[model samples]
Target: MPASRPNLRTIAEHLGLSVTTVSRALKDGPEVKPGTVAKVKAAAEQIGYQPDARGVMLRTGKTMQVCSILYSPEVGDYGDPGFLAQVESLAQGLEADRYSLVVLAQTSNKDPLEPVIRVHTQRMADAVVFSRTTSQDSRAKYCLQHDFPFVSFGRTELLTPHAFVDHDDEQAAYDAVKRLIADGHRKIGMIDPPENLTFFGYRKQGARRAMTEAGLDPESLIWMRSDVSVRAARDATTALFRTQRDATAIVCASQMTMIGALEALMELNMDTIRDGIGVVGFGGMPFRMLSKQKLAYYYQPQRHVGEVLARHLHDLMVGVPAQELQTLLPYRRIDDLAAFREGEDF
Candidate 1:
């Protein structure tokens, strides 16, 4: 079959180096000589090598491919449109070397570890990156126990530490809720993601902490879980208000959750501003485009996440300690521009 892009054999031929040496140099593997890694990488850029890690593995058992286990980064999927940006950005960053980012889709219904296990058993790639992490995640645990190189988009609890890049969800949630309380919102509500994921717990923890600190009973806050779709959010929000029509503010745990909440309120003939309801959530673009009123939200540098995830994975494959590679990217709070013009670091 015709190659879609340049392969290891092509790089070796162009560099006049053996395929074995080129493979080692690509992965910074054993037997790669000093200065040769530099030469192979340089030629990969000049010649534009799209890596064929599986082909390399066939001969030398080493690869320079990084796989990303992801969901379809469509609107309202997980309230995160950043997932697509991450893959594209990771590809752009890895383009500097022969490393290629391979995307493996993970549906919500499947076991979280299935995709990771596929990579582990097949050895199709050198390392893996995945998101939608849970506390005591099986994927992270398996990767650690098997001595594989991997990076998670969220934290995991294990005896061993591994590379990760994550948003500070707990702190972000706390700050969002605290802002509502400060604004004189008493009957508060929260729309949360599924409780199975670790970030879900972090957001819940932060909101509850903020409520407790204000001398309010955390249990009194209306809490509901939804899929981030307008329909799901509307239903949850409707039920939420049925119990407390006087709820003055809500903390939405996700972009979709926020959007869904807004729709529900509109259906109930309520305007966020008209009804004196304050909305704060995680997401950026859609909030501005969709909402008639300005929204206070938590936004992440998602493209930067891709760049860092790529760098972290490369560092790990080349022997960077997992613990040293852990990072928590802060979420910026974009307050209503009419009231607060700039994003505050949170």
Candidate 2:
């Protein structure tokens, strides 16, 4: 009868049953009689009574909710396409499994793990998924120490076991670089992410390994490191060109950065995949039509990552041990340039 959202107490009062009986019946507890369960279910449906997530967590030590903490300072500005896609996918997947998601954005100066700690302490979330991990990340460590159910979207350099869903960045970068080498391009350059981020470092390592396998001098390869920002990527691209005018190809770590690099290349009047410069970027962008036709790049299923993560969290919540510590999602290359020339619909 109240205007506010219905809770267990309200439902119990309407159904002429104790709150405990109502709660157990709603959860289908064996102690609750089948008739009582039916009555409670029907009453809940009639009044739209939803269990308080925090109260359920307090009573059962499980929150049917997951928090995704975004640590990138430029999360709003740079707008990681993969991250956004994953969030959307994860939300949908969780909803299908009767769970909810909360997004927490952490800025540069803030401790990324603080939100997770607060949520856990307040019994607001059952689990957390962290993105953009670093080597010896304090957030991961904190989660481990607190025995919180958490997973990462990226891997750390640590030896300890932690749940994660990530793409094989090292192998992907290696494969990308090898593709360029096979295309008769030598003196390749890379616009890598900062070393502080383990994923970026792994990508760099893969690129170097690929160069070595191709019998190219690693030292001769131009490499620049910067934050995962458009300006940073643009600056790195400009710097690479300034230092090595003969460099014929550029590898980028992200689509956003690649856009900036492409703009820089256009400004310098360098021919892409024609006169001299060839561009290859990692991941797909929301505004993919802007990319030049036939650009070589690896594309990760951003939405699939989120879907897998949500499934994993659901398994954990349902008393299943999530055994897979790190699940690597699959990726593919868009090799056809002309097919994308007229801007194919996504």
Candidate 3:
């Protein structure tokens, strides 16, 4: 095959130095002489050298590749249109450390971990990163048993030692519910994601907790559960309104769902907020831009999640302790322009 990009071999031959020396210099290995490192870097820049990812993988038994499996970002299958942005952020995070990201397509719902297992057993990647964890995630167990370097975007119920980074979904949900309660919404409703997902349960708990604290019967409220899709959310909202006409407030699980619910209300000619109805949901990025009257939401630390996941996985690959791999980053609540205008950090 033709050389698609500059390789370490090409740089080594140009500088008349061993490929090992070139690799070490590029990585800034402690043992490499500083003068040699500078010379190698200067020569690499002059030749426009771009390290061949495959070659590096072969030499160190480390692909410097992080693999993540998610629904195809191009299709926006996860309801959130920001899926592509998240993937790009992850890629950028990995690229900063000279690592490459392999985003695999999860076309089917059969088993999300199948591709992850394939990649690990086939030695196609260095570390695995996955999200949307369940209560008892088999993928986490598999990685633990095989002793592979991996990190999760959410926590699991398993007791085994593993690394994970997650947003404080429960707290964010609690805040959203509290906002609705303060608005004097008595008959509240929730548009929830599937119950099997770990974050879903956390959010559900938050809503229930807020209702109980306010002396409301959680069971009396409407709960419309659906998959991660705007169409599903729209249909669920339609059904909720059809049944619980008294529902004065609704909380959606995602931004797409919030949009769907809004459209559904518009179709039904229901006056949003004016009819004493309010909406709230969560988003990954640019949450402020999505806000409008009666629509309140928050943005997850998604870019930060990618950055931390990449860095944590790198630490794991380099023999860092598994205990240090876990992190729970805080999220920012974006209610409206006021949050941004008031100098609240996003």
- 1-346 in candidate 1: lDDT tens per residue? 8756877788889979999898789778867876999999899878888555566677768766789887653343444676777788999888676677888887767887888999989887878988878889998889888998899988877778899999999999889888888988988888876888888888889989999999999888777787756567778888888778788887887777777777778888877777788988785343454346647888875778898888898788778888899999888887654323334332
The TM-scores, one per candidate, come to: 0.83, 0.85, 0.89
Better-scoring candidate (lDDT), 1 or 2: 1
lDDT of each: 0.79, 0.78, 0.79
TM-score, cand. 3 vs. native: 0.89
TM-score of 1: 0.83
Predicted structure with the largest TM-score when compared to the true one? 3
Where in model 2 is the C-alpha error above 4 Å? Answer: 1-4, 7-22, 30-47, 61-63, 122-124, 284-287, 337-346
Cα lDDT tens digits for candidate 2, 122-228: 87777889877899988888887887888888888676777888878888888888888988888888887777888887787888898899888877777788677
| Model 1 clashing residue pairs (backbone) | none
Q: For candidate 2, which ten residues in a row score worst on lDDT?
A: 285-294
lDDT of 3 by residue, 75-107 (tens): 465456666676777888877677888877776
Q: Enumerate residue pairs that collide in model 3.
A: none
